[model samples]
Target: MSKRGKVWLGVAGLVINDEGEWLVVKKSYSGLKGKWSLPAGFVDEGETIDEAVIREIKEETGIDCQVKGLIGFRTGIIRDEISDNMAIFLATPRINQPFVKSERELLACEWRTPKSLVTDHLTSAMLKEMASSTPHETQFCVNETVDPGDIFGYTSYKLFF
Candidate 1:
């Protein structure tokens, strides 16, 4: 198969509440429309992955979050797109607040347990890795580096890291 001539680096956050549920979103486009997955999107130039995670969570779920640690990264090759890389980080909300869904872009928002989400056919590899790992005692065996893409209206965000 041939690549789609595009490069992309996406950042996603695994924000769990006191109840131990991860925040997920229904994306509106970019091959993920109508799929329930972790809240994430393309990172921008001059934007750190941490900031992207925080902003993406807020924008998608309307809940403020802070990155706890970098869990790890996962790489995948689409059938016709450039090979993809997604960095998944651990996060928590600043305040114990519930989220309200956005009126645009996202179709819905909900908190789900890892066991239920892991086997989903619609689940992306990024989320599956996070769900498969033990939250407190995970091991990092490798390092991954990736480049970012240019998606219009996708701007860098400032957040508490």
Candidate 2:
């Protein structure tokens, strides 16, 4: 069998506005389309995690933010598709305006509370992680060795309380 290889690496942000609501975006593309998630994207070469988060937010929501801390990390496997890992972080928006940057990649943007977010349709793993009140770090591993191409890639997000 051929050796497993690593592929793309991405980063995302969990930016919370001053209203104490988290930012969620509706993707316009396939895979996770119609799903609400934080503003996130790939980490470009020579870019730090914080830089990636800030840049992604600006590109997606037209809002600047400051990275506060890391919430946790996640790793997933895609049997015949893609496997990926991500870093979630906590952040606060620098401005109070709504999302102005509209792109084909995103459909909509809104602010929602953690409690309300849990009730809404969200990624199972993200919902569980948001429900916890404890401040801790955790990592998830997959049973099968994921092919680099099968890996959805790595992303980092900022979480705010």
Q: Report the number of the highest-lDDT candidate.
A: 1
Give per-residue CA lDDT, model 1, range 1-161, as digits (tens): 13324666888888889889888887877666666678887787788888888888888889998898987665655444455667878899899786777778787788888887888766654465557666556455542322112332223311111
Q: Which stretches of candidate 2 lie over 4 Å from their true place?
A: 1-5, 80-83, 122-125, 131-161
How many clashes does the backbone of model 2 have?
A: 14
TM-score of each: 0.72, 0.72
- In order, candidate lDDTs are 0.69, 0.63
1-161 per-residue lDDT for model 2 (tens digits): 12334444556677877777888778787555666777777777788877888888888888878999776554554443344556667789876776775686788888877777666655433543554444443233222322223123323322232
lDDT of 2: 0.63
